[model samples]
Target chain A: MIEVKDLSFAYRTGEADAVPALRDLNLKIEPGQLVAIIGHNGSGKSTLAKLLCAVLYPTEGEIRIDGVPVREENQWEVRRRVAVVFQDPDDQLVMNRVEDDVAFGPENLGLPREEIAERVRSSLEALGLVEIGGRLIEDLSPGQKQRVAIAGALAMRPRFLVLDEPTSLLPVPVARRLISTVGDLNRREGMGVLHVTHSMSEAALFERVVVMDEGCLVLDGTPAEVFRHVERLREIGLDVPLAASLAHRLRSRGTPLEGDILDGADLRNALAAVRESTAS
Target chain B: MLELQRNVIFGQFVDTGSPIHKMDARIKLIATFVFIVASFLIDSFLGFALVLPLLALIQLISRVPAGYVLRGSRFFLGFLVFILFFQVLFYPGEVPESSYLWRWGFLSISTTGLYTAGILGLRVIFLYYVTTMLMLTTSLVDLTNGLELIFGPLQRIRVPVNELVLVFVIAIKFVPIFIGEVERLARAQTARGVPFDEGGAFKRARRLGRLLVPIFISGFARADLLTTAMNTRSYRGGRYRTKLRQLHSTATDWLMLLLVVAWMLAAWQLPDRLLS
Candidate 1:
């Protein structure tokens, strides 16, 4: 399990003045958990993602990965478990070609030739990138490049994959497909995922959602429980899923809708049930 | 905007599955060294006459188009002409008064100047051809592996061979990426009415200078990301890194190395006096 206790972080802009990015926050992610953290700009979701990956350490508190405190001396332990895919694919990819880039992580671990090759092959196949294994990264589409970046990260076989808006630059359909793939990887392989995104629809797809506002963890539960606080979310410059917002609007207009609605299917069924109950 | 990726093919690989492309990168590297040495040793035009046919033969064997190969060098060759013209105009080398083809206050062209400039130009072209062919045939992976292994002995003496070779390889690999960035910036400038293509060489050069600022800024940003990405992947300067692909030289590579060595020796013994 990854544990964060009273974690606070700030970026030092000057010698005396420091900008607080993450206030004292506490969260726990169990093994094999799939969670999404949603927040607006400057809400500290990205900062939390970076801190979890050991790229940035907390200033006031501690993060423990599998019981070991994440410190500079034991950073590799944190990194060995949590791998992050950054926002831009161009920034992360070092190799010219797809397969080479996938193999890069395994090669860095100083794995033997056979193991590295196997990792590269499996990573490429997992990301459905085997066809373009030999193609140049520069020639790939933005979607393909993002997929390649994810594949490179997956090659490391980290227990928790932290995706920091990996699909923010992609088209909607492409982003949906990429998120669906990550969801499948989570369910089928029992891999942990901390998908930090601003898209509420994408967050709604995950099992659990964590809401961050002003560097504090304001809400944490199943998607249904989190999306129920649409007012709080809106006040923090965040939006709930479209279906949830529609359902909330209907309820406020004196239309009774039952149960916490998160996605379109839930809203549709709830509205149908309300109609059926009225007719009966 | 230019076809920054497609048009720049001189240093890009063209995999033909030919024997030359399949040869060990070490042999190609050694052959390139030999060709550079031969370019310096052979002072006679007749020597280049022999060397040119050999390069052509290798080009044919490599199966890349002759037109494309020549097109790759067109811009460099144009610039080379201007350079050689200045070299001949200055005629800084000591020349007999009777040997002067044309003479002015500080501007002169002599037989010796002509000969010196001609030889230097040919040598440079030779170097360019050999290096370009090496790049066109060998992939960056092979180049890095070859360089690391070639300099592996220096590691015992505390030289960071693997890191140095990786730095060199990454620089060459990013050349096209940066070129594409420049092309995009130029297009942006043109869209904003910069008159990029309407200028002479001097104006074109000054305009090109404007693109460098953003390129460097973007380059640094990219570098920062790449560094973090590399660190996140556990890259520790390649100290304990084991390669996924190992280099294995073949008989054909050995034979190619032998042939190049022999040719370099023969070219060195060419008679410059007879050509004069």
Candidate 2:
């Protein structure tokens, strides 16, 4: 499990006063849980992702990865436990070739060649990128490049995978495919996922959804529970998923939709139920 | 109109999986240096006949097409020929009477001048071939590992060899990226009515310079992102860092090294005896 206890982070800008990015955030992620973080730009979602991966240290409180505190001394351990995939696929991939880029993480950890090769193979296979393993990273499509980035992280064999806005640059279908692949990894491998995204639709797919606003964790619940707070979410400059918005509209029109509808399937079932009621 | 991608193939590596391609990169690097230095040592055309065959043998082992290598060097071949022409026409230091074939006001052609130009041209070709072959055979990761290993001892003297190696790696990796960026920038400018190809040399250069602003800004942005990526991957420089693929020289590598040493010795000594 990953635990964040009263974690606060402030960026030391040029001036004497530091800009606070996160304030006393408390959270816990159980193993194999798929969690999505949603917020507006500069809503501290990226900051929280960074802190979880120890890219940025918490100014106050502590972050413990698999029970090891995220300090300078335990940095490697923390990194080994939690690997992060950043937004831009081009930026994250350091190697020219796909296999080499995937192997980069394990190589940095100083694993043996055989082991690194094994990890590279397995990670590529896991991401369905075995065919492009030998190809140049520049030649691959943006979706494939992002998968390569994730494979790079997976090769490290981290317990928790933290992806910060991974699909922001990807096309809608490509982004959806990428998320499903990630979801498959979480389901099959039992890997804990902390996905930070701006897409309400994407957020609604997760098992749990967390919302950040003005450097504070304002809402935390299941996707259905969180999407129900449509007005509150809108107040924070965030949108509800399409289904949830439709449900909210229907409720406002006195259709009496009983529950939160965060996905297309849910909306379909709910609409069918309404039709059956009216027909009866 | 300039096919930048086609022209910039200096560091393009071909994965032929040949013996030379599989040879430890450090050994290849050392051998390249030895061969280049040996190229300068050969004084006679007879020596070059011996050396050129050896170079051809290395190229053969690398399995990269000789035509491809030659095509890659086509951009610089014009410059090389121009320099050779000037060297042959203008005998700078001294002109022996017996060696002079033709004479004009300040330009003269001599046997010595011809020989000097030929040797200089051969030197340029050999140097280019050696470096190009090295790149053609070795992947960038292997190249970086080889560089770090070769310069590994310098770390004791606080030379920051790892950082230097990273700089080299990043610089090399960015060549194709920047080339593509320039292409895109040029295309955008072309859409905006910039005549990139219809201009004279000066106009073309100035128009090309206009593309640099966006490329540079994007380059800086990329550098920023790359820095974060590198740091996130736990790149703390060369200190206490270990490699996944520990470079181990094979029997072929050793044999190649030995052959290079022997060739260097022969090239150094045989040229004088043959020339005299």
- The lDDT for every candidate, in the order shown, is 0.85, 0.85
Weakest lDDT window of 10 consecutive positions for candidate 1 chain B: B1-10
List clashing residue pairs in candidate 2: none
CA displacement after TM-score superposition, residue B8 of candidate 2 (Å): 0.5
For model 2 the local lDDT of residue A249 reads 86
Error of 1 at B256 (Å): 1.7
Per-residue lDDT tens digits for candidate 2, residues B1-276, read 655766666767778889998899999999998988888777667777778778888878878887877776776796789778899888634865777788898898888888888888888888888887888788888998999889989988989998898788887778778887888889888888888898676798788889888999999999988877876776666664555566789887899899988987887788787667
Most accurate candidate by TM-score: 1
List-wise, what DockQ does each model earn? 0.68, 0.46
Output the lDDT of residue B9, model 1: 56
- Which CAPRI category fits model 2? acceptable
